[model samples]
Target chain A: MTEQPTEGEPIRTGIVGLGKMGISHFAIVNAHPDLELVAVADTNSFLTSAIKRYTKVEVYKDFKRMINEAKLDAVLIATPTRFHFEVARYALERGINVFVEKPFTLTLEEGRALVDLAKQKGVVNQVGFHNHFVGTFAEVRRLVNAQAIGEVYHVTGEAYGQVVTKPKTSTWRSKKSEGGGCLHDYASHVVDLMNWVVGPPVKVLGAHLNSIFSEGVDDAVHAVFEYKNGMSGQLTTNWSDTTYRKMTTRISINGKKGKIIADRQEVRVFLMPGCEVDGYGEGWSIKYITDLQKPVWFYMRGEEYSTQIDTFAHNIKSRNTEGENTFASAYATDEVLDMIQKADRARS
Target chain B: MDRILFGDNQFFGVNHMSEEKARAQSMKFKDTAAIMKVIDVAYSEGIKTFMCTTHDRIGEVTDIVRDNPDRYNNFTFYPGMPYAHKYANAVGELGIMGTLKKFAPGSIISTVIRGAMAGITQDAYELMKMLVDAEMQRFQGTRTPVVFLQNVVTDLLLGFNMREMFRAFHDYVQQKYEAEAGFFSMNMPMLVDVLHGEGIENPIVCSNINKIGFRMCGGIEKYIDTLKTKQFRPIAMSVYASGAIPPEEAIKWVCELPKLEAIVFGASSRRNIVGTRDLVEKYWRFDN
Candidate 1:
């Protein structure tokens, strides 16, 4: 087991990868009161050198050497998807807490192995499925759990963005094996949101992956899901939609007594005449993200990012193994992604 | 600062309330001239200050104002620094070294050498000064009475508990640019307290101060308390909560707040601009 820090002592932390998300996480981690960012590792010399020049933290070109030398109590992994399993496993084996970015692993087997290893080590582990911390989305889950929308019959999850409008050079995102496509980068968020608000689909009834702008990778994903209790849902995600200025994820739930439509900004609820939910009235009620959100200590991009990091820090401090966005929970999402891919391949 | 400062969100397709509206505005203002037309309208309506992000396109707008001194004689620009997406896009296209070489203010050799020294000394303030100079490059030949640190960087520094950077920015802008340094943040209460602790009296801090408390961190009550008790010049943005509140109610409520130094709003058309300006005028009087 890892040595726990004394109460009030900061958690010694190390981070691997210096991509866009990595840099954002680095900022947040460096600022967190509970985390003392000790070291950072990145393969890109320019990024590492720039970070070294700016911050007092140690920088290394090799993550393994950094992890070995930094004496870190925890590690945040934001590397490309294919590297997740190996990096996470290496940390977990050392009894170090791990926080891996979303699309937890490239394959289901890898995700399962990491989840099992994390459990065996009894470490505080989390996946960066940030939407679970969004106020509007969290409210949706609460209302659904409260059965505010009684006897849920159907749900629809959608995400669209203008990630790639023109033909671009190949980055890690354009490579399917490197987790560059919409199915992994964009659709994973929608799928995880759906899983969090509603339940994960037990069966993938039908699925199709389309490539609108990139080669060898899917830019759009359409899938139909079936729950064990006979509820059904659909997911539609397109990263090539130029109409959107940025990524927008929305989930609509229709039930016998009411309906709920939620996005990153707000959540709208409709209840029948007799249906009742606290703080919400019948017919229609709108709740904005501003009213629902709690004040984060540090907010960049969104409160959810900081919230997730804070939660992870708290879990590590309290040694709470099972928490929001755990390794097991992310592994379940990976299973659904696998099923969707298999269904799409069988049809094609 | 102007009491009713104009904002640049509408011209840049940044409607937080509605994506459809944002997309429509993006389409409508694809040309720089279209944006200039709206600015002309706001100017005609007596809103003389343009509080804008340092987007690349804004460089063109500044150029227009710089050239036609007769048209924009009394106009002022409150430029917020580090339009973060610009840097992100630059890093994506150009490697980190290339991005620094391209955007750093001084000669390339000096930039790299100073960058290394700043790293060795762990001098974040020196690096921050360089970035401030880089972002302020486009505002040359214009009347920038107040320069703002964007919410992204301000809030990040607030989280990092780096109060020295805030002071550095405040002092640097005053000494270097002859301008008062403004800060845009999501958490006004915390920022005000930090600045107050740093002995920066009556600092200029802009945040989302609206009737509905939209995007106002620390809740509406804490914000009210800060306004009532703190000694900071408050500039209210997102006054309508991205159209969630009607112009009449939003202006009425915000104008009633204690010591609200300014209100920054954005609109695309003459009608909306005139409408908001009239409402602000009805509630709050501008002596100047």
Candidate 2:
């Protein structure tokens, strides 16, 4: 294992895969002063050479070779969902910190393996569930923890879009073997949010998985989840809804004291009779994330992505075991997805 | 295909409008005999075709129909496959791969190997084909002239742009099972357009066709336009709009449509069956 970097020294970072998300991470890693962009690996030499022109970083077509010889402090594997397990395992087994993208792995078995490996290696690990870092979502979580919504009873997460209204057979997203469809692509975020706010679902009550826009994979996932704390919820995500312009995720949490509805732009809270939250009396309170967010250097749309990367960088420096976006927590969402995919009715 | 097909929603307690009524129907039709009595009423009224899902209870009905050749010699079943619940229930009983192995036809050894290699090396199309073969197993030796692709799978295929599977299912039924393929979808207008685009001429489509467009997707105007122009067989269902439309108005509006070839409805009593039959007989007439 490499020795921990002393104060004022940047953490060496390498990235694999130069896809859209991969490129986004590359920009973030390159821009961050605390993290040094060391190397990148992808099959496309054009992409590799393009990055080489801008920075004096090593580029390789082979990710394994980059991991073996790069002498990196951490690696961000931004490949598809199917490759997350193998890539993360390779990095984690060598005592390198990891920041893999969402859905963790396609299945629970693989996700659990990564979580175990990260724990065994004693390295900082985080899954790219950027929604968790959103201001409104964080605020909602804070209020819920403060008993703003007392005794949570149920939750519902709806994510809809018109991305795949037609057939999409060209990419990995269309194939079930490659962790394709809405359940893995979009619902993964919603599932993670549900687990974060309400708690991990103990059971899946009913599921209606449809490949309404894609073959072999599900384009829509509508499932009912029963949480451990006597709470029940439903998750509905359709990636082929022509009615929606772009993808949007909206979550509603209903507790005994009140209800909170959170979307991208804002959070709306409605207090009930038994409300006990301080500073705010019952009726309704609206908080827009736009008003609360601070400006970042590389601001594309939201700072959540940058915030997560910064958190991962700090964790690596401090030798923190893991953060809120741990592989273990992400594995819970994978388990719920597995349960919903495999069951027709409620499963305990 | 029969002009009037009887549905099994009442037998299965699928009343969309009233949960209490659905619960009562579920309690009443808890036994196969109760379901049989309703089917008998429809049959007695000359409703010979039964367009039904491949639910477990329907297996009993199929057995009864097979046993009584004299009474139900002309009864035809338009079996809908991939009964979404069946796979889920099976998975709950067995593990996901175990359920796949169990439902996949052929010897246990080959089935296990196929199930094991399903998502890895093998294509999901083979798995879907196997699922169809498994669901169609119970209706063997019976009159299943038109095999249906349920809306759960139908609309999914539409959304995915996997038109090849539609053609595959159509070809599979025609070549292997010697049956015409039919599609049941919530969105009739879109389904018709998609089926036609796939070179499927005059595809038989069953969808929600009511006076008020209860669940008729793609809007009522598009449906009317498609009905007026498309060269396909249309089967109107949910004519009563789950008790929203008056019986006479619902049946009359649907039966008078330009390209409607059949209407499927569910009723528990002889009186309702007779009423439906008389309404169809009165409104559906030849122009020439």
In model 1 chain A, where is the ten-residue run with the lowest total lDDT?
A45-54
DockQ of each: 0.30, 0.01
What are the clashing pairs of model 1?
Answer: A173-A180
Candidate 1 lDDT score at position A278: 96
Top candidate on TM-score is 1
Positional deviation of A258 in candidate 2, in angstroms? 0.8
TM-score of chain A of each: 0.99, 0.95
Checking candidate 2 for backbone clashes, the offending pairs are A212-B156, A212-B159, A212-B160, A213-B159, A213-B160, A214-B160, A344-B88
- Model 2: docking quality category: incorrect
Question: What DockQ results for candidate 1?
Answer: 0.30
TM-score of chain B of each: 0.92, 0.91
